[model samples]
Target: MDFYDKERLTALQAKEEAQWITFAPFVFQATRVLRNSGILTTVEAHRQGITLQELTEKIDLPAYGVRVLVEAGLGIGLLVLSEGKYKITKTTYFILHDELTKVNMDFTHDVCYNGMYFLEESIKNQKPEGLKVFGQWPTIYEALSTNLPDKAKKSWFAFDHFYSDYAYPEVLPHVYAFKPKRMLEIGGNTGKWSMASFAFDPDVNITIMDLPGYVEGAKGKLEELGYGHRISFHPGNVLDETQKFPQGFDAVWMSQFLDCFSDDEIVSILTRAKQALNPDGHIFILETFWDRQRFEASAFSLQQTSLYFTVMANGNSQMYDSKVFLECVKRAGLDVVEDKDYIGVSHTLLVCKPVK
Candidate 1:
């Protein structure tokens, strides 16, 4: 909340801006088409700009189609027309070339776009009604493990990895500072963090606990990386109250993991994690807490992501505020030992130890 600026718009300006909501979907698809149809890329390549005729010939679209799309793009400030030639704007260049933007765009379009239509119903039922767009699953994680479409899977993982992967290098030093010989990774999706730990120290052994499908996927990845011997796997649903977390870990890792569950569920998982740890063991949690964001844009993006969780991911989870998350940690009997922010793009690492 502190990250956003106060709205101080005039009445006329506020009304003008409000109209954008009406045509937002049209603009979204138009920009997507501009990117997908090679219009943005083609225009980017030509610093001097390209005419509609030349653009049509380059991308194999009809002149009428090119003109209409280019005009729409101009209205959106993604493109500009100067002296009868269409040029990519700086904003469009970033949209076309920025990795984060590309990943987020793909994730919104391919994964969360159509499903978001059921947002109202999902809110009403307190369940992910939008999940019907993909298949009947309580959560998207189930669909991810089972029958998610390939393109959606690609975008989903891309969005997931892009945010957390940047923080690995920065976070590795903190994890290694403990010099933990035995580490446990909760929610070890695809073993990216596990692999990082193994590479950080050959002698360190990692045990990844996650759903069966994720454990299997991590096993395959570790095997391919030749680090299978250094890592072990435990497959179980962490949300099940009857599920006992494996013990004997010097440190527990949950990178970008806790936000996937509801507040009560987070407390439950953290309590189980506390039980699984040695008396002196620590838990490292990496997440993009909305309240901890350094930039307004980061906070806004996470707010939108909360809606994705509401409509498509799970019914109740969200990109949490740090205050709420810390309350859960305290409720689960953990005390923060080290709180580091801005690790990589937008992540905060909270190092916790069991409260005495």
Candidate 2:
């Protein structure tokens, strides 16, 4: 190779090495905690804002260990110390405490931490051992609630602020805005979507259906939102033989619900949804899709979808190519009326009607 070509190759190699060196810290869970220690620091810092000695006393940690953690956090831009006291930095505040940020820190902590440790074994065996660790997929919820209650609370708060209360207002101005008098939210967790829809369109009434426990949670949120009168709950496996829904729904909204099933199950859901819909009623589906043209998508989303599908739920759910999803809709005898991409993340709003 020429001298110029050799120089360019050396520069590229240095850049690649630097990228790995930067991200290498993230591969270890300890580094991840340090990266996101704002919450821990802020609470401790507030409790001990008087001085480092007080902070050390309040947290009940060795003074030396506290100093080490604090210093490392400062280097990582997560904590700022001035006048011999520490506080959460600006980067940490938004990243750790913001209402709308999409970071799933708890999910990262629990699921990925437990699962990634077994990545090599999983790859070798061609199966996920994380499910074995948790005993079952439903147990993930229990473990999440038990182990990381505070982080889970914040995670749900983020969901409520962004996807529930705020999303409808942001989306209503678009063309084909839906204002339905009767709506159903399948697998509606905590009734965020139902509450938002009720709030946005006063005349709209919503029913949220989910597993019994989640249904109860939804009811509580609805009551808190003062939407108890207009929102109702049905608690049962909607996919089972005993599944039943009241008739005459003007629109059915399944947000992040359908992807948790196999193609056959998805078809069954469509059929049941069709049954619940009145004439001229519509069905709205919100989920991510996979498009090969997008390189960012190719890098992560497809693999994540496959892994999530394999382990998250029924071991069958996944992100489908748009064409595959459309085919499933057609097989269910639902006509695709509208499909709109939400963001570059393959999220889209699909509107469908029953084929007559």
Candidate 3:
């Protein structure tokens, strides 16, 4: 209750809502079904509202199925029944048409929904037991690079890109302000940010350091874009204790990358990045810190995403609070030169210099 207004408390209502938490999983599945089964879209198509019979005929669903889903939708406030016809509500409009909602829904269903069943075990064991739903990989990153299911992989990348892609335009100016001739991008998954940097400034050369699979994928993309000569690849696992980061870069960039690691690993990686920098070099770290979010919903989304890391991704990392992340930076022999918050969506940009 530290963040809540005590005077506005409604104990009974709160208790009732708490009880309903038991039904959240069912409710989520129902919402997904309503959206995917065309019931929501069909109702939206008829702005004047549509009868149960009309919905059944139009969606090719049985009357019974239509009746149950519509009733559930009404109970969930996603639909309203007026004179025996169902109308999509304002909330339903976002659910049906919002791009963020679509990406989140698909991501939840394909990537996290089923895997979440092992959350309890994952929490108890400090391991991603839920990841067994897919295959036995230490982290989802391995599965992503190797043999992950097609739909899940698509949803995962979509979810990852949807949030970070918007921030790139804003970030490019800050990176280029340093007038870096050679920049090293760590954990450069799929090379999206590297490609963006190339587009932003054609003269700046980029070296992508990441897992071998990702390096190969990035190489293919750069080659296809005829940017093969401008970008280079260093294939290695940053988490490996003995691995040393390649040196002599003017700047290093990590976009939505460090959050994939625990605090200890973050410190280790940053320490290596510190070593890899030139005397006047800088390192840019971009992350969506839960504590730095402008909106409560953004913070809530990040908090929920921590569970995905716990149960599906790596079982150890989380969306860190800004204070905790900054402490890690300090421990790694770096000093924060600038802290810029509220960059496209919930991201915060931390510009750090090696401690001299």
Cα lDDT for residue 104, model 1? 94
List candidate 1 stretches off by more than 4 Å: none
Estimate candidate 3's alpha-carbon lDDT, on a 0 to 1 scale. 0.90
Per-residue lDDT of model 1, residues 160-273, tens digit only: 999888999998998789888889999999899988888888789999999998999989989998987788899999989898999999999998888899999999999999
Worst 10 residues of 1 by lDDT: 1-10
Each model's backbone clash number: 0, 0, 0
Which pairs of residues collide in model 1?
Answer: none
Q: Estimate candidate 3's RMSD in Å.
A: 1.5
C-alpha RMSD for every candidate: 1.3, 7.1, 1.5
Error of 3 at 40 (Å): 0.7
CA lDDT scores, all candidates in order: 0.90, 0.63, 0.90
Report clash pairs, candidate 2.
none
Candidate 3's C-alpha runs over 4 A off are: 1-9
